[model samples]
Target: MIRPSILLAGAVSVFSPFVMAQDDENKPWTVSTELGVIATSGNTETTSVQGKIDAKQRLTRWHNHYIFSALFKEDQVTQDDGTKTTEKTAEKYFGSIKSAYQLESEHSNFFVFGSHTEDEFGSYETYSTVAVGYGTRLYNGETMQLDAEIGPGYFRGERVLEDESIQRESGVILRGAASLAWQISPSAEFKQTLSVESGEDNTRTVAESSLSTRINDAMQMKVGFNVANDTDVAPDKEKTDTMTYVNLVYNF
Candidate 1:
């Protein structure tokens, strides 16, 4: 299992150098950290936590993005022997980085992306992917914007079987993604993102929708829903997973 501290440290190490090297006169880096937690005691003991970090940097001709997220949950349950014990119910970690080179057109760019995921209780134990693609703004309006991208990529994944055996799958895939953002009001915003990767053995799709309202100059309240689906999975496993969360976001 991947620890949250390890993931946080890796993210900071990866971005610290670039952040420190930037000049004051240059465009500043935009970074946001979000966290949510739930805990219960007495009658039932349960704990859940989610955290995410997002960072973006734009230079004269390059745009870069970094993301890291983690989820963990634990519950106290009675065993067959009537003994109560705390056990982890869910754990997941995900990280991705993308860099785009700005073309002559302001809305078009070429990008290379890579991502990795680890899920202790999902259909897939681990997955990693890399791709190169061209992206462009499909629409730009006063209050909304849309962007899309497509490319060929490669992925490697480990699937868990009914017998608890691990099966490794690797193949080329076609990936496509789109995102839309709307400014609902001066202090509120809504965003939706979707992505799909299709290969010979399986197809994976993910979608997220979120709404955030500014609380202060550097803080916001956000609610989000996320879903992930796999076309093929073990007989004992489900093909889809969903998450709903409310978080506090700190931006800089």
Candidate 2:
């Protein structure tokens, strides 16, 4: 059963008149197929299917803006019984945009951003986070990237009976991600990723790595793993439970 909000989002997408009228030079889109698994400490494993969309446009000369993103599956879930099920799972979505300014040919790029994320197991909320970062081209084709931010944010829980804590941490945090794209042929590409994320109260650390291949102009596929830990995993209990998710992504 799809949630009301998921149905609403899809309806808006289908009826979005602006989506088709936007100038040829004004929009972009990406779609993908994703697969992954989530593990909690020594228990429960859930696998999932994932998909993503990204678009960009230059609103001005000083700031060539782009929104890079993706979201995927409700069930590709790996249950304790070791069977796959898509039932009772929730849909996930994420979108973000940034206005970047260039300072040099290969040395600097800076940006400010705002984003929204809705995970299969979490709430959907808007964020007005600001980031200043630098990017430099490396190895003639590969690139290195880094950024930092501070902001107030919101989150929601998926399970109604589960804990309901909406307001997330608000403080300075550092974010970094790097991907190496290998040009295999004129039309095909391969990518590898490395990322680390941290936030205030020294809470919630995320580390991830993945590999993907671009099969065509509209579609791509990925497989990866991610691990997350928090300072206060169980608010009422003294124990902390870490989570891991093995992921596969498809984009078109």
lDDT of 2 by residue, 1-252 (tens): 332222111100222223322224444422233433332222333333333343444443344434433444443457799876555454545566666666656334565555544554432232224445655445563333333323333222222112644545455656555556666655444455443334544343445455555555433445455554445333542222233333333332
Deviation of model 2 at 22, angstroms: 17
TM-score for candidate 2, residues paired by index: 0.51
- In terms of lDDT, the poorest run of 10 residues in model 1 is 4-13
- Taking the tens digit of each residue's C-alpha lDDT, what string does model 1 give over 114-148? 99999999999999999999999999999999999
Residue pairs with colliding backbones in model 1 are: none
Best model per lDDT: 1
TM-score of each: 0.90, 0.51
